[model samples]
Target: MRIEKHPILTFERGKEIYFIFDGKRIKAFEGETIAAALHADGIIKYNTSPKLHRPRGLFCAVGHCSSCLMTVNGVPNTRICVTRAKEGMIVHSQNPRGDLND
Candidate 1:
């Protein structure tokens, strides 16, 4: 969920845009991070751990961690938490090796 109104901070949401996530269309705002859009759209599962195959989601919100890694426009291991959401972008959940169709 997005905080539209905040006491300390302000949210300057841009024009609404659409993107493809795992073949499903998702709504997002311009300049917002991909992870933020996904979370706002109720998508919490970003990827799975490479070894144990456990579920993983956004952890650091920064680009320093792999928890938010996923394939964006066929690019694997992309840090979605810091990646800006764009119109018509293709995103897919990573497999055990952090890749889709790899």
Candidate 2:
């Protein structure tokens, strides 16, 4: 979900990248945030709201809100929007209290 063409702006795509999402291999571009990469791969939902387990997604692309929090390599509360996606990294949706692996 990135602008393919812009009148005033341009994007120079980096090298092809790969990461692990929910135990599946997802292809993406280097230098893109985890959320952006995931969104490009059709992953919109990040985590469920605490307590209610209500689904949440990209409310704020910036890391100022809790909507995009997820587990990255076993660490909880990671703001994927600002976290660059690295090759071979493990990413999983976070639950109410912690990572799915926790």
Candidate 3:
């Protein structure tokens, strides 16, 4: 769910770009952030905590926090909140031990 009728910001998206999230195909915008795209697709849990395995989602919406960490194209610990979405980008949630979630 998003603010479709923002008084100041336009709701129109950029050029369409396809990507993989958890082995599923998802369409996002060219210049959108990974977290934004995931959020748009109703993916709120980006990672799980180490010991407790608690679900984590976008908190700061910036690169300053680890709440949005995930795996991008085989790389671990990627901050999706600040990383710009790209075409064919593979994104997956990162487990607490720094591995991609199955």
Best by TM-score: 1
Q: What is the full ranking by TM-score, best candidate first?
A: 1, 2, 3
RMSD of each: 1.8, 2.0, 2.9
* Cα lDDT listed for each candidate: 0.90, 0.85, 0.83
- List model 3 lDDT by residue over 1-102, tens digit each: 556788788877789998999898887888889888888889887778878899879999869987887889888888889998899999888766566436
TM-score of each: 0.91, 0.88, 0.85
List clashing residue pairs in candidate 1: none
The Cα error of candidate 1 at residue 11, in Å, is 1.1
TM-score of 2: 0.88
Q: Which 10 consecutive positions of candidate 3 have the poorest summed lDDT?
A: 93-102
lDDT string for model 1 (1-102, tens) is 788789999888999999999989999999999999999999998887989999999999989988988889989889999999999999888887654455
Off by over 4 Å in 3: 2-4, 100-102
**Candidate achieving the largest lDDT:** 1
How many Å off is the CA of 65 in candidate 2?
Answer: 0.5
Per residue, candidate 2 scores C-alpha lDDT tens digits across 13-53 of 88989999888788878999988888988989777888998
Q: Which segments of model 2 are wrong by more than 4 Å?
A: 99-102
**Candidates in descending lDDT order:** 1, 2, 3
